[model samples]
Target: MRADAARNVDAVLRTGARLLAEDPAAGMGAIAAEAGVDRRTVYRRFPSREALLAAVFQAKLDSAQRVLDEARLVEAPVAVALHRYVEGIVPVSRDWPVDVRRMMRADPAASVRREEQSGRLDRFVQRAADEGLLRADVPVAWARATLDHLVDTAAHGFPLIDPPQAADLVVDILLNGVGRR
Candidate 1:
């Protein structure tokens, strides 16, 4: 695709994510208007709203995979990996705020991709425990869940804190509880 076309697609997908997130029933014309693209462009690229939504979800997954690849979860030190993952993912999470579970329900392919992502995170969390970054006694599921919640909190709850600082806060909270030490 040409540079301008790619830019238009990116704008459409991003605007679609934001508008659809705010209102799932948002129309293609509205999205195009918000994205500053022609409605024909949106319709040309995505025959239907569902297709556009699927594309948006795929964009989120692609971004997530990129973050995981960059974080080097398997090779990096657990603490370092955790911080990198959080820092990279917070913005991705915020940028593509679509719910993975909902996407999974709508598209089986998305479900598989999400499961793969979850599996990798699970392994990393388990590694963290094995490496003494997390308590061995804590169930891996619980730890992963807490980590997920923390990332979500960092992404959505702390609007003022930048991603890097949010990552630091998340890592600290995950490693050491909010309870008085």
Candidate 2:
């Protein structure tokens, strides 16, 4: 596609994502109006609401995967990688809060991507355990789940705090817990 066409597509997808997050019932017309594109343009790019939603969802996933890849989770020190991952994902979760549950159920490709990301995270948790960052007695799966919970919490709550502060808080809670030592 041409530069302007690509820009329009990006605008539409971004507008669609924001609108859907605010109201799942938001339609293409609203998204187009918000994006300053014609409704026909959106229709041309995505035949149905589901198609647009899927594209928006896919774009978020792709961005998240890129963040994880950039963090070098498998190669970096576990502590560093954990912080980096949380920091990287904050914007993705905050900006694209699409109804991921519904998308995962409705889109097969999304389901596969979710599993792929989960597998990577599980491996990263295992590595942390092997590095003695996580207690040996704790199951890797459990640790992974905890890490996911922490990241999600940070992502959801980031608007209340600075991104770096939120990332630090998440890492601190994950590594040190809430109890006074």
Candidate 3:
């Protein structure tokens, strides 16, 4: 694609995301109108509505990367790290489908980021285990998997109040195993 074509595509994708955040059912025509691009260009760039939406979502997730960075999931204690994880993920949780799917998809760039996230979470879990703060037998990989599920829920699961009521409880359940000592 030419430089102008790439710029036009990015513009359309940006417009589509802005519209979709307000209304997921926003139409292709509306997006094209917003971007001042023709319908042919929209279809030519994205091929399908889902593909376009996916691109919009990836952009949103990219914008959200700093939350994970601030959480310091790999730098802090397991329990505190888990709490920060909830705080980090809740904002982006509003648009769960796009965020969760794009993160989990096997795209090389996304995967590298995901692995970095996993490694950070792992380091925290390792520290917690060493401190006897978590179940010593809990595998770092399992902790990472549980976090992924929790974050995905924060994203894609049923909605509730703003900031989400169940996040702390769910994180607690994951860390504590929900059984009597």
Best by lDDT: 1
Question: Which stretches of model 1 miss by more than 4 angstroms?
Answer: none
Q: Which residue pairs clash within candidate 3? A: none
- Worst 10-residue lDDT window for candidate 2 reads 157-166
Off by over 4 Å in 3: 1-54, 74-76, 99-106
Off by over 4 Å in 2: none
> Could you tell me how far off, in angstroms, the CA of residue 22 lies in candidate 2 after the best superposition?
2.6
The 0-to-1 C-alpha lDDT of every candidate, in the order given, reads 0.92, 0.86, 0.68
Model 1 clashing residue pairs (backbone): none
lDDT of 1 by residue, 68-156 (tens): 99999999888788899999999999899888878999989999999999999989998888888877778989999999999998898
User: On residues 138-164, what C-alpha lDDT tens digit does candidate 3 reach at each position?
Assistant: 776776677667766655464564443
Q: State TM-scores per candidate.
A: 0.97, 0.91, 0.61
Q: C-alpha displacement of 52 in model 3, angstroms?
A: 3.3
What's the best-to-worst order under lDDT? Answer: 1, 2, 3
